[model samples]
Target: MKTDKKKIIVSVTNDLVSDNRVHKVCTTLYSMGFEVLLVGRILPHSSEVKRQYSTKRFQLLFKKGPCFYAEYNFRLFLYLLFAKYDILLSNDLDSLTGNFVASQLRNKPLVYDSHEYFIEVPELVHRPKIQSIWLWLEQKILPKIQYAYTVCQSIADVYNKEYGTDFKIVRNLPLKQNYKPAEKQSDEKIILYQGALNIGRGLEQAIKAMNNIDGVKLVIAGDGDIREQLHDLVLQEKLHDKIQFAGRLPLEELAKLTATADLGLSIEEDLGLNYRFALPNKLFDYIQSQVPVLVTNLPEMAAIVKKYDVGEITDSLEPKQLADKFREALFNEKKRKVWKEKLPFAAKELVWEKEEKVIQEIFKGITR
Candidate 1:
């Protein structure tokens, strides 16, 4: 059951695709000589998963809601009990319960990676009773976690203060690239929004803003809760000619679409602390594509925009105001030249290679 190299069982709640941060972490672990096995759940309509290491995806009894979480965790607990792993890596709150219990019982090291301020996410912000259940889980488990890290400084500070735990910062950055994408041969310029089509993501305002932004197509390249609503809004607003729903794409295809764009967007509305402090993975993906971004004037994202001189930051998501931003990003030649020159340096600096060293530091002496 045991091999020469240590075995790691990395767990996440989502299907093993599109979650670049967790995917990068698992890849890094394997490169460091660990035998990696990534475990996640399978939806009825989930895409096929292809990874370098061994993998498993559970077909659970429930699809979503509380029952799904319970079923997944219960199933995961049983799997971990029998699975031979020297270390356990849990991504986010949903998978931590099983990993935590298994770690204690089997005397294995556990590392927790919090992808976001989970309880304060917009989905749970209005549901206090449901939020409390997650809060309770965090309260009971987080303070006891030794090797824990999060995506940004804001989330790390909040968790460290609340739980008195020394949580590290491992930002959601893309892998370093040596390849260039072929530019589009289209006449119309493209303005892209390439993350989840979820609420509080400023997609509605972005679509409305396109009414005045002539000659540029607004390409939405992901799918989520607001999928139908967004499609309806496009027709209702009569923006079929101006807006294109690219739907959810795999990372490679998404990068090509991103590279073809004139500008990238990460204009999340400040609904809760989760959104307020979000340093979205799409932001880094844009950088990797060398596409300049127009992002919210929130602390975490604004810091990157300002620090790198990558693009503009706006305080409002008003349709008229958003149109102004789009116009400037698309047509302002002087600003475009500045952003174009700055993007490569930002891309090189903000890569997973630098962040994975911190992971190495956390897991030092962890292998036998």
Candidate 2:
């Protein structure tokens, strides 16, 4: 099914190897026999990740420094102009400017994938003027684009209602279903937390909950700006034995560890609409692994968790209340079994496979 036609150019703002969206999308495109000219930043080499597709990286000179949005856009614009691609796929607002320019120059279709609500980003939440600028840009740019998509149904509806644009829903689901090991250690019930270690992500609550509970261990498997702060909090609370920082393990290793976990955690504070409606990849990761969850009481998350009866949900922000719910989830085997029963359905229905046809239809619309 391989075609000799020109490749699709997908631009991303982050390191491609580590980011879930870029990594999964590139793999999916390769599987569907599309030549993907992936443009991203190159990270330090690690034997852990062996990428499967061809990529054209614009490696940034400084690894750690202040935000260089202008510099990044200029470099990416030059690269996109020279790359000569048939279709332009922009990951987020960060790279949208370059993609928009490239699409106009080359007369190619542009696909914008909004992963998060940029206006409500934690950093920009307090700054009204900055948020206004982002909103203005989105209003100016999003309408002219022919194809658009987002992570969840709620976000898609928001875009459709606000911008009068039709956006396809593409949930960030896991690629496979896995079973728990035959013999998992019952002594240490592993409570798993992954994704960026940010404030209002319910990590502080997860840490605080451990203060009251015993015989439970938490494995934090990712890194972020707040990681060191969380580590310091764990030390301050003297819950060293109960909490462990796995420090950004490889995807394969993280999956294996997830399979062994007793419960998965995806609780975000309702600080913004984006966090309020998040259906995180880790939630599906837990489902694929057949582990129940302790999720927040957000409507979007609650719809799935309550539908499947897979885990518990709480709107309470209190640490003690969260701990009590965790205790109940850990102890009640019957309640957990109800959630586990939906594993096969959750695995099959809630994946990227569901979005492929919708994506194809959008492409057909643009091409016609």
Candidate 3:
């Protein structure tokens, strides 16, 4: 029963449990008749992933810092060098080097999906030498990639201009669902922030803003490096009653939680190119759940918010301003109704069913 089908190997740097984007992509590729194997590393705290397609997670010695990257890439290179795959799919710049080298050595096509502007991440903003290394790697490998896609147009434009490579945009939209709006729990409003609890995400300001607003609870439903610090901030501000952390729910539970919220927040600070251009998946989740949003006035996010009239966009990240905006979004019944009315159409438009066609076309081109 050995059927002849093209096998694709996709690599990323995160534990695969909560990566809805990667899961969607892999599922699409599987449905399209490609034998897909999604690869990632297993951390000490990594949870078990239940996927439709095959997955392989390497358990490495080092889990963070330079050693981690080096060890993971070296191990990945070896794995890709020997493993059977017709196409190599690299998730981001961090996983590109090994995949690119393996593809070149094996004479297979390499498809890169840049999740963000890697060199312009907040983590690398202060580290010049490390940033330079990433930049060098990107410059070296990008020119060789024949099939490439990114999460958004702004990021794709930067890649195209910088490397003279045409990268297609396949946004990280939510899958179409038969969504019914959840009934509100009580008069106390729920303000939600659902993504990586990382630096430059404006979580600190959001927490601080909660102090100024009353009769509302802030629920943060994700985990990252700064989770401890954020918890400490909540304690220091004495906003324990106002702020609660629901660390890293699965996509299903997250969607349910999103539906229950009065307002969704994506207040990313403009600390780097990636942050400025970020059209986070949580925004789409909010839209799909028919919840209003309060986003930062960044180009990618603001355009959608304005176009669909989903919510308000603020130019300032100040606590007072954020608190005021939150109050307005929550208490402004007329405006909230208008935003809710637009959500169905926005949800219909922004979905995986529409975006997957572009992915199918790109893979068809690659296979041809």
Q: What lDDT tens digits, residue by residue, belong to model 2 across residues 312-353? A: 898885889988988888878788777667766776676666
What is the TM-score of each predicted model, taking all chains together?
Answer: 0.97, 0.93, 0.98
Q: Top TM-score: which candidate number?
A: 3
Name the candidate, 1 or 2, with the larger lDDT value.
1
Q: What does the lDDT come to for candidate 3? A: 0.91
Task: Output the worst ten-in-a-row residue range by lDDT, candidate 1.
Answer: 359-368
Which structure is stronger by lDDT: 2 or 3? 3
- Candidate 1 per-residue C-alpha lDDT over 49-150 given as tens digits, one digit per residue, 9 for 90 to 100: 899888899988888899999999999999999988889999999999999998999999999999999999999999999999999999999999988999
Screening candidate 2 with a backbone cut-off below 3 angstroms (N, C-alpha, C), the clashing residue pairs are 310-339
Which 10 residues in a row give candidate 3 its minimum summed lDDT? 1-10
Off by over 4 Å in 3: 1-3
RMSD of each: 1.8, 2.1, 1.6
